[model samples]
Target: MTTENRAGGAPAPAGAAASSAFRQPKAVWAVAFACVISFMGIGLVDPILPSLAGKLQASPSQVELLFTSYLVVTAVAMLVTGWVSSRIGAKHTLIAGLVLIVVFSATAGMSGGIGQIIGFRAGWGLGNALFIATSLAVIVGSASGGFAGAIVLYETALGVGIACGPLLGGLLGNVSWRGPFFGVSVLMLIALVATMILVEPTPRPEHRSSISEPIKALRHRNLSLTSVTGLLYNWGFFTILGYAPFLMDLSPLRLGAVFCGWGVLVAIFAIFGAPWLKARFGTARTLYGNMALMAVVSLVIGVFPDNRTAVIVATITSGIFIGNNNTLVTTAVMSIAPVPRPVASATYGFVRFIGGGLAPYAAGKLVEHYNAHVPFIIGAVTVAAAGVVLSTVHRALDAADQEQAHAGHSAQRADAEATA
Candidate 1:
């Protein structure tokens, strides 16, 4: 319920807090389990990109549209997730997302051509928008640990799901690319049941958010800056994620193994490395350094596209930095924004996802028109630009972090005095 900070805007060492931070009620774990599956959707199709291209008779650019269609729809629909959840309640919204994913994923598997599968993926994206928008709010509201702990739990699931997605896709793609789709359907169905049985229904908020509210939240300066930074970072992030698979020339299984290793690093860094680094370096410094490092990594991948081993190592290496960015940026968004959490989340999601959706599609075009290296070169430049953007907001970001620590410290003191 309360927290204290040491020097330089860091929370007091989490030693005393760590034990209880991870302990959660069964309901929390159930939602977390579902979250793992939900996030797996991000990378679930990665290992099958080549297979899909071959079987569907689609070009690399067409295959890349799979990412484009899904993420574009998801980004556009993010604006309404808060509005929809406020009316329907979180449980039903989550179930609706699950149902859509199941139906669309299965339909994608059965589709006759690339066009049909791409269309079906759009529908799946809408489901993802609803689920992802609400899942964080639900977990934060229900979890036993403090806000930091809940974030850790959520990021942990993200790391695991992302790590496992390629592995599952690889294994299933070995049988048939269709296998991954059916597998997600079955896994999500189980997650759906667990959510229904274990997670309690969330009551609607007192003042329901309007569709316009998330858009309005962007009027705040800090929120906009953070969102723009996210957009640029995402451009680089997805460039590698969306385009690199084609260059590997490995089997689906081998590709999965590489990303799986990447995912494991993502998990480890998000949980342990991020907090530790932020505590020592602070958010602004850490982000600047990390983004710069990512730029170099992306360039390495681009410069040596034909070097299988370098590309592979860089791919896995990028995960550590990506994991750090995911946690820190999410925290920064929550802290810096003055609007309600749901609205802030929706707004932030809307802005950043545009870059995420566009980058992969553009990467495909770049490869078609130019060389394989152009996308990564462009990705590196944009990522470096994001670090500069974040630097411009350094003062406000530091103030927000300090205020959060002060507020938490005051609460802890109040509790101590009352008990005494």
Candidate 2:
């Protein structure tokens, strides 16, 4: 039950902490496994976008509504996730989320038209908001390692799910556009069962949260600034995720392969690359450099949209930066925000998902009215703007890094004493 410190009683290095991230309890793993499936919903429909447009007789903008509905609903619903979970407890909240995803995803699979599928996806978004917010709280509350380790573990699941989602979508979309939807329904059903059985019951919070708390949390400058920056970053992130497939002009299978490669880099960097870079350069500097690189990558994609090879390579390359940003920014928000974790999460989710929700549809419209290059050029600008917003909080980022390090050391000492 105790983890010893390194020689000379120094706290374990990042490598040791990372290794410990995986050595978690069954309950944690159960939730983590469910987290993987829940995250899969984000990219599960990606490979099917073009297929949906063709088969449903919908325009690309209409098809893009799939992202719009899901993410917009998710953003709005995030305000209530903490309230719901606080009243019902984390276990029931998680189950409620899983159940909704199962029902909605299955219905989406059977929908007769683009409009019907978009509606069902909106319902799916509601479930995602409830599940995603609560899962982070549960993992941070119960995981064996400290906050940093838990984040690493959580991001690992996100990376793996993202990586796998496109591949699964491709294989299934090749069969039928509905295949990915049905696949998610079945998989989420299984994850639901596992979560219900393996995860222990959790009591409701002693102080129930109001729906307004997340919004109120935003009054804190650090929380608000980070949330705004996340919004800008997501504008670029979702532009690529939502709109890039049409440009690829590949088969569903091939598009899946491309995104799967991107996801692989996302996973690798999230788990390993991010922590190493943060330790070396500090959070602000790491994010500055990473976001700049991402802006450059987006610019390349914008300039060379007609060149399939260039687009593919740049898209995949962008994943490394994306992965690093995802982990580091989330960590920074969790550490620096002067509010409870759930509230901070809900607030941040509310802001960021809005940009994500809106970007795909915007991209579609831009392409319709202007050239293919316009949306991505705009995406590159928004990401570069995110870096600028981040700079205003450089001192806060340094403080968060120091705070996390101190927390880590204190946790190690506690474990060492308990063992002795």
Best by TM-score: 2
TM-score of 2: 0.94
Q: Tell me the TM-score of each prediction against the true structure.
A: 0.93, 0.94
Task: Give the range of the ten consecutive residues with the poorest summed lDDT in model 1.
Answer: 411-420
lDDT of 2 at 386: 99
Which regions of candidate 2 deviate over 4 angstroms? 1-12, 407-420
Candidate whose lDDT is highest: 2
Q: What stretches of model 1 exceed 4 Å from their correct place?
A: 1-19, 408-420
lDDT of each prediction vs. the true structure? Answer: 0.82, 0.88
Q: Least lDDT summed over 10 consecutive residues: which range in candidate 2?
A: 411-420
Q: What's the lDDT for residue 259 in model 2?
A: 93
